[model samples]
Target: MKKNLLMWDETLFRDPEVLEIDYLPEQFEFRDSQIREMAFQIRPGLRGGRPLNTVCKGLPGTGKTTSIKKVFQEIEETTKKLVPVYINCQIDNTKFAIISQIYRKLVGHLPPSSGTSFKQVFDAVARILIKEEIVLLVALDDANYLLYENEINKVLYTLLRSHETYEGTRIGVIVIISDMDVDLSRAVDARVASVFRPTEIYFPPYADAEVREIMKARVMQGLFTGVLSESLLDLVVGQTLKSGDLRVGIDLLKRATLSAERAARRSIEREDICGAYEISKYLHLNYTVKTLKDEERQILRFLAERSINDHEMNAGDVYKAVRESVSIGYTRFYEIVKKMDAMRLVNLQYREGKGRTRIITLRYDPIKVLEYLS
Candidate 1:
């Protein structure tokens, strides 16, 4: 009998959900200040006042979304005067989609999928808030997508100025921007900016010690005792620090544990961690790629194919290749490239020459990008 072998019904994970990306841990570490500030901003909503508009700026995996979730959870438990609606802009970047989400949250059902106009839907939402005297606090996660789609001003202007139209309807917005390169000041029109003042909240990357502590807490809750050794845990932390994203570490832990289980082992090992990182390091890349539109993906596919032979190419060359399949103009092609550059999917640089040409380079391995796209 093999003592280390996992039995048919046996497993190492104590609570598998804790390792999931969407899992909200009971003990959220290293974000106390952020949590407090968020609570303070929304405190007024608890007493029938509109919540302050906030701009949560940070790199991905830095607890921006989690903080919002935690605060929203508290609001739900505390009162009904404040209606907290969280919208993922990646999935719903348009004004209609965002307002529909708010409507569903307040009206208890979705509006007509097609026949209903935006005005009808918007009016219904405002009327309900006015009748119920409920304040709306909407958090737009990954708001940069709204910017890419040219919908930021429309969304903000509508939400921020709802009171002007409906007198009693109060709506506030919290925009969560994952990309540090996006400048909201310059992105929005002056009209939207005039009424859309937001208190900026920055979430910096966690320190190495903080990362280790958080990982350890997750390990204790997620896996059984002695399933992972201290040294192996250190290695995981080191890999996470190298990537500068905590999600990679969390995904690595889950993948490595499964790798051990696949081998009929009860405990994780060094080889499992190393093997898992090959896939886990691209966690962010995989997520960002999924949110891209058809044209953006086509541009990335062309770049990946071209990258195999040439490490870099000029913007004009990429545009020419992309035009073969898609009917996009030079200006539109340049806009797509700039959006991808902001998303950190590729590197955009300027070449100092007579022509002042722009250079483009893939940030990840060409093979990996192709695999994800396919």
Candidate 2:
């Protein structure tokens, strides 16, 4: 039994790195236009000219961030005249943290954890760029998170108009926005907005043919041939389309492969794929719920409970019910619902008729949510 437990198959993957989400493929399929557009906007920085501020707007998992990374990788390989700075706004959504990240990319050291101020870091970053005679092209991925945190305008104002404060210092900004609900320009200062008059590029959802091609490419690079059958691959691709995100398909495939491996299978079969899909959904829901605040979780539980009986309750109704368990104001409740909507835990739709209430439609398994917290 011990020997059997240790036994496994290495027949699938030639290299472990190929399957990692962080792995950048040598060949990027189905994003030629985005890659080219990003390159064009960023190319000016290499020539000692201002980079055209760029905005890559797309839904989550639409290759927006990866395409930017691919171009930045190429830029780094070919030139030292420009430095590429990538900061995920979700983790470093504050003004200070974002500036510190830029400073780290430039100086090869992190800013002091607490003592320094934003102005000090900004001044140091500016002075270094000026002394080195190089441009910094910064990509703030998932930048819309800044908006939710009310830091979007500050980040944009700080980056786009940064050069204005320092004579002869050049910094190009690329904003990667995943939230399509908000009109960001109206939220920022006009002067700051003027500097961010960017070349806008959009990445739409991939078609089924496109998804299949992507899966096939990943299969070649990640798994051994025949480890995943065409039919099972189609199953993943078809289900992934419902979300219109290729990363979900890639994730589903990787998780499916791991599920198969656990069963000591030589190849991934239909049952393995089915098991992977269900497990992935559960894990995804679990991880998201794990990140919520105690109060947020409390509200989520109430909504799930509310939805079980009514199956799409009014947003106001969920809040009123939740208040009995936790003393939260209506405004706070509305904010929590919006937060849940952004998290994709529930879908919020406004009704124009019959009462004109905001409808809350949960996106996860309500029964599992109860079990999840239990």
Candidate 3:
């Protein structure tokens, strides 16, 4: 009788080793030029010159944050004179909150939240940076979150123009955004915009071949023998491209591995990949619940229902459908749409030959959501 190679129990093996798979770059395969150009901007700072302000924009999971972060780590290792501070604007959306994060990073102490006015907090920070005469590089990740809130101008005015306010102190700002074409020039006052004429860097999506190479590298380092069939790798790449997001790719791979482990299988087969898709569907829905505001959730639910009645729906049609069920203010509704676009829940595009009109589609297949909801 032939023995099954996949048979296993919980105690059969030690834990699997997945290399820095979570960080985008360990699994990141391409973008040689991007790293070189970005490195050049920071290298000059060592020789006592102004660090360049760079704006990194790309769809989610295209490695914008990861690539820059990698370069940051390398710079920090190479030089002790410069300071690098990174803040995520999604969580720290307010100007005060972002400044507080930077303060704590630079000072090694959290700024007191009580008994300190906003101006006083910033004044103290300026005084310290000036006193130390340290070169500061502040990277604002997810920068677009601050634009519409009218916080961009204020934050930029303080950080970029601090040199003018406090003589001999220099600061650099690196803004990371998801949308490249978002017209933030008008949102920020000209003074601040002119000061932060960031070198624009766009991160395009990974090619299908690159995606396959990334997964193969990850599987070799992360999985044990006989797991992850060649056919399954192709399946994962195809689904990831259709989804048009790299987080989806990571999510799929992680879930599939877990599915195999749950079944006590030493070898992951085709069934495991299929099982991973089912698991991803559940996880994606949970992410939707966690990140989206109540209004955004309602809008998504409305589109799920409308998509059932009709296959493709534009932005206006979906908004009308949502309006029927809720009393949402127009401004709030538009804001929710933009936020959803940022989150990759809904796809937005301009209609070719249709002036100023945009088309919207549910990024996920509705049948999966409707079935899950039922």
**Top model number, TM-score:** 1
Off by over 4 Å in 2: 1-6, 9-11, 281-298, 320-329, 352-355, 367-374
Tell me how far the alpha carbon of residue 31 in candidate 1 is from the true structure, in angstroms, after superposition: 1.1
Give per-residue CA lDDT, model 1, range 1-374, as digits (tens). Answer: 87867987888899999899888888788899988888888888888888888999999999999999988998899888899999999999999999999999997998999899999999999999999899999999999999988999999999988888999987788999998989998999998888888889999999999999999999999999999999999999999999999999999999999999888898999999999999999998898899999988998999999999999899988788788899999998999988889888999999999788899999999999999998
Clashing pairs in 1: none
Best candidate, lDDT: 1
User: 1-374 in candidate 3: lDDT tens per residue?
Assistant: 23543455542122344423345444345877787877777766666566888877787668888887887787788876677888887667677888788789777887887987777777877787778766778888878777745578888888898888778777888888876656666667888988888787778889989878876777776666457778878998787777676667667777777777676666666776677666664555554445455666677777777777776667776667677788987678777777667666677777765566667677777776655454
Task: Evaluate model 2: give its TM-score.
Answer: 0.88
What is the overall TM-score of model 3 with all chains considered together? 0.79
Where is model 3 poorest over a 10-residue stretch in terms of lDDT? 11-20
Per-residue C-alpha lDDT of model 2 across residues 1-374, encoded as one tens digit per residue: 64433255354565556666567888878899888888889878989988999888888777888898888888899988799999988578889989999899988998898888889999999998899898889999878767766788888888878767898888889988887775667767787877888878998877789888887888878888778888887888886776566666677778877777787776788887777667655545775677566888898898888778788788776776777779999988888788778867889999988778899988887898877866
Give the 10-residue window scoring lowest on summed lDDT in candidate 1. 1-10
Q: What is model 3's C-alpha RMSD?
A: 4.4
Q: State model 1's lDDT.
A: 0.92
Candidate ranking under TM-score, highest first, comes to 1, 2, 3
RMSD of each: 1.1, 3.1, 4.4
